[model samples]
Target: MLRSLWEYRHFILASIRAELKGRFARSRLGGLWFLLNPLAQTLIFSIVLSQVLQARLPDTEVKAAYPIYLLSGLAAWTLFSEILNRSTTIFIEQASVIKKIAFPRLCLPVIVWGSALTGHVLLIAAILFVFLFFGHVPGWSVLALPLGITLISALAFGLGIILGVLNVFVRDIGQIVAIVLQLWFWLTPIVYPASIVPERFRWAVDLNPMAPLVRIYQDALLFGHWPQPLTLAVPALVAAGAVTFAFVLFRRASPELVDAL
Candidate 1:
């Protein structure tokens, strides 16, 4: 599958470019809208939650700390949810291509991930700019962001392909996914700090796979702290194992999935 994707690299790049153009084609501002949406969301959330949840966040010298904290977590969460959500129906979205195209079937999800990553890059730039306004520089720990993104991307992609394959057979899985993501978003500490959760119920936060990933982002961007090597090493191992399993599963089921479509 990796070799197949590499061989069709041009096709993948073309598809990603077309996907971006198509998404912004109708918007007056074009691709700027991608940056705008997240900026607007950060503003609105900062406005509402900043005051209400201000007490929960740690005492810090960083100006506009809440917004920085919120946006950092949001960055990781956005990439995650976008990939998982898109992956769930990517095959269905490309049903015609899957049925008629002779190229590798794996490219479909790669397209989804690439398209989403394009938007995410824009958002990350926007987030870093916002940090500047708050008198925060990109700390040395910011260097760790790529590794954090890699871990979560692998996790999301691994889970997404699994659900995507299952949803190809059971349509109801998509419906359940919507609800699950909604609840999952709240369960993770995107808008609020994990510190606010009662200690007794903190296990919910601890068990969530995305929690550590979000913390990695927040720790790097907001607190200027790099996690211990062991902290990231564990998830790195898990993500690698999970992604390999997902790709194997996806490859094995490709023929049947194409027929189902």
Candidate 2:
């Protein structure tokens, strides 16, 4: 699959471009929607939760600390959830093309990842500009964003492809994943800081794979600090394992995927 994807790399790139163009083809805002949606979500969350969570934030000179933290975390979460959500239905949505074309099947998830990462970059730039206005721009640690993004995208795509394959047969799998992602969002602490979690329930936070990944973004963008290397151990290992499993499952199920569609 890797070689096949590389061999058809141009197609993957073109498909990503086509997907991006098609998405905003008729919309007036076009690419601005990428920045607006996340910005709007960050604003809504900040207004509703900032008052309640303000006291919990670290003592910072920056007045917009909470909003910065929320935006950084949301940027990471949006990239992750976007890929996961779309991957679930990608095959089903493209059933017509799948039946008609003979391109690399792996291209679907790669295309989703590329398109999502493009939007994520825009959101990150907007978040950084907002941070700049508040005198809280991230330091050199901002360079580590690609590493964080790679892990998050890998994990999301891995899990997404597995669920997407199952979704073709079960149908309920898609709905279940939708509900699970909602629960997963709250569980990962995008709005609230992990410090606010009660001592007894801290174990649940620690158990979440995304907790560490999201923390990397928050630390770098909000606090302008390099992530503790040890913090990435779990999610990195899990992402590797998940990728291995996803490909194995996808490769084995390749033939059946079309028939199921």
Candidate 3:
């Protein structure tokens, strides 16, 4: 699948460009929408909760810590959600092309990565600028940002493709995933901190796979600290398994999946 996808790299690039263009085709702001939507959400959260939970920001030294904490974790969440949400129905979205085109199906997800990566690169840059303006440079821990982003992407794409494959057969899976993500988002510690959760209920929050990834971002981007590798080991292993399993499922189901699409 890797070799086949590489062989059809042009299609992936073209698809990514076309997808971005089509997404904001007639808008005056164009690509700015990608930056605006998430940042706008950040503004609302910043206004509502910045001071309320300012005390729970992991004892970080950064100024404007809440928004940085919020935006930093959000960057990872946005990337994961974009790929996962898109992957859920990517085939269905391109059902017409899938029916007619004889290209590799893996290219679809690759295109999703490219498009989302482009937007996220800009998002990170914007975040960095905000951090600098506030005199809260990320320092060396900033290097770990890519690792956290990659892990979250792998996890999201892994889960997404698995569902995408199933959704091709069962359209209801797509709707179910949307609801699950909403619940998952609240369960995550993005808008709030985990320290405030009661001890008895903390187990479920700890069990959430995204909890560690968000902490990885918070540690790296907001706190300027290297997350303990041991702390990340479990989710890293799970993400690897998710990717391996997704590939197996994709290979096994591609024939029927194409027909169903």
Highest lDDT, which number? 2
Query: 1-261 in candidate 3: lDDT tens per residue?
Result: 999998999888898888888988889998777668777988889987765554446676556888888887788789889999999989899889888878898888778878988888878887888788777888898888888888898898899899999999999999999999899888888888888788998987878888888888888887778978887888898899999999999999998976797
- Candidate 1 segments exceeding 4 Å error: 52-56
Q: Candidate 2: which stretches are off by over 4 Å?
A: 52-56
**112-142 per-residue lDDT for model 2 (tens digits):** 9899988888778877877777777688989
Q: TM-score of each candidate?
A: 0.93, 0.96, 0.94
**Which pairs clash in the backbone of model 1?**
none
Of 1 and 2, which scores higher on TM-score? 2
Candidate 1 lDDT, tens digit per residue, 119-153? Answer: 88887887798678788886799998888888888
Clashes of each: 0, 0, 0
Task: Give the clash total for candidate 2.
Answer: 0
**RMSD, every candidate, angstroms:** 1.7, 1.4, 1.7
Top-down lDDT ranking: 2, 3, 1
